[model samples]
Target chain A: MGRVVIDVMPKPEILDPQGKAVVGALPRLGFTGFTGVRQGKRFELEVEGEVTDEVLAEARKAAETLLSNPVIEDVVSVRAADGAAGAGA
Target chain B: MGRVVIDVMPKPEILDPQGKAVVGALPRLGFTGFTGVRQGKRFELEVEGEVTDEVLAEARKAAETLLSNPVIEDVVSVRAADGAAGAGA
Candidate 1:
């Protein structure tokens, strides 16, 4: 099966408490020199066929509507999963 | 600033309720032809300088120790953010 990857991130202007928590914890965990962090969501959708442009367009529509909240998040990427099985098939 | 992107996914053998819910809801929402959905996390970390190999190494360390639960999640990818404002600067 083909897989499409979707990435949704909080808009740059939005507050991301999860990201804040992570950035805060990094230093305490001794992972330093990080100035900031933003946490987002990634979804992998498996289809029965090849990841054609038609499939990608459908995935993009799904990404904007069901996968992410357009009010606060941006659908940063909607594309084929790289180099994976079925991606190049 | 340079940004590194880390992707974490639930191990294939693990149960993912969120992904289940999404896959279940998709057909109901009139989006079909998708067989499965797996949800994961994406994190963008901003550093003060260029994304050198050393910086990427640090990000990898952070990803393994802090960003993912090795028991349940896999760190799928960790690399410099692509073509963003600070990524190539």
Candidate 2:
């Protein structure tokens, strides 16, 4: 098996209200000296089989098709965990 | 300046209701052959100065101190953008 990780985020130009709220709440939570804190989402999947290029491609397609919203958000990256063999196979 | 990216997630044993809802909605969204979709958060910050260990440590402290919920969520990883030297300085 293999592990695939996907990071999805809104474009920088986009306004992230949730992130803004979190950032606004940070100072009260004890965080200081930071300006912006943009928030996004990450997805991790354990797939059956080896971490082949084919598997990676399929996962990308899956992400584009349903796992993420291509309109408001972008799939920033997709990576396979090292030593993921036999993980979910 | 440096760009620090932090990924936060619930531990593997934790139940991600949002992720579960997304996963349940995937098939309707046309995704197939995937069993799970776990969701987490990522924070990207543009900081002033070089990407040295000190900068990284400060960023980590910020994360642990306020940016993330250390009790319910773990700061899975932190990274610097590859070409962040002139971006935020």
Candidate 3:
């Protein structure tokens, strides 16, 4: 099976409390250098075979219509998952 | 300012109800071509100046120590947001 990846992030003007919580916790955990944080969503869609253009288009449609709220979030990307989840790392 | 993006996903064996919900909703919305779905998290960390090596290291450290739950979640990627989030799209 192949997979498609979709990323969704809050619009710049939206206030992200979850991100704020993380930003607040970072300093206490002694991790610094970050001025702000925004939390979003990532989706992996499993398909029967290769992630064809048709598949990507469907994924994008799904991203736009079902996965993210257009008013508050933006669909950052809808790309194929190249390999295993940990492959790139 | 530059931003660092961090992606966190649940382990393969874990059950993702949100994803399941989406998969169930897809066909109902007339959007198909996906067999399954897994939903995770995306984080953007804003920093001043540049995304230096030091900053990446800190982001990675924060991702590992604070952003994810070790027993269930995996840090998928910690990358530099090259420009305005909509740039690559």
Candidate 4:
């Protein structure tokens, strides 16, 4: 089996209300020294079967199409599990 | 500045619709071997100033309180940047 991690974040320019709310509440929670906070999502995936380049590419396409919003977010990075090191299939 | 990464996941018992959908789409994406996929969120944070145990603790608390749902989700892990390595403030 292979693993894939997906990170989703709001576009830098867009105002992240949730992030802003979290940042604003930090000091009240007794945290000092930080002026701002941004929040995003991370997804961990375990793919069944042998890891291949084709599998990786397809997974990435699926992520881009349904997992994240290209306009407001970007796929920061994509990596295959250590066991699957072959170049794209 | 210090960096904090927060991993949020749905409770094992709770059905993760998003995760389920992704898992179902894997085979169509040409991946084999695994049968299930679970998805979660990751937040990358840059906190200003020196990193202390208190800062870390406070951050954790904030995540539990406002960032994650204690009922249907859990904070899988929390980590600080290399620069901040002090024990509790």
Best by lDDT: 3
* Interface RMSD, model 1, angstroms: 5.3
List candidate 4 stretches off by more than 4 Å. A50-53, A80-89, B24-34, B50-54, B81-89
lDDT, residue A64, model 1: 87
Displacement of residue A50 (Cα, Å) in model 2 is 1.4
What lDDT is obtained when candidate 1 is compared to the true structure? Answer: 0.87
**Number of clashing pairs per prediction, in order:** 0, 1, 0, 12
Task: Tell me which of candidates 2 and 3 scores higher on DockQ.
Answer: 3
lDDT of 4 by residue, B1-89 (tens): 77776667777778989888877876676554546666766666667765567777776876788778888887876677554222111
List TM-scores for all candidates, in order: 0.94, 0.80, 0.93, 0.73
For this target, which candidate reaches the highest DockQ against the unseen true structure? 3
Of candidates 4 and 1, the better by DockQ:
1
- Model 3, B1-75: lDDT tens digits are 889999999888888899999999999999877899999999999888799988999999999889998788889
| Candidate 1: residue A61 lDDT (0-100) | 88
Model 1: colliding residue pairs: none
Candidate 1, superposed: residue stretches over 4 Å from native: A85-89, B85-89
Tens-digit per-residue lDDT, A1-89, candidate 3:
99999999888888989999999999899987788999999999999988899989989988998999999889989999876774434
> Which sections of candidate 2 miss by over 4 Å?
A25-32, A83-89, B27-30, B84-89
Sorted by TM-score (best first), the order is 1, 3, 2, 4
What lDDT tens digits, residue by residue, belong to model 2 across residues A1-68? 56788777777678989778867876676665556777788787766676678767877877676666
In order of lDDT, best first, we have 3, 1, 2, 4
Candidate 4 CAPRI grade: acceptable
How large is the interface RMSD of each prediction?
Answer: 5.3, 6.5, 2.1, 10.7
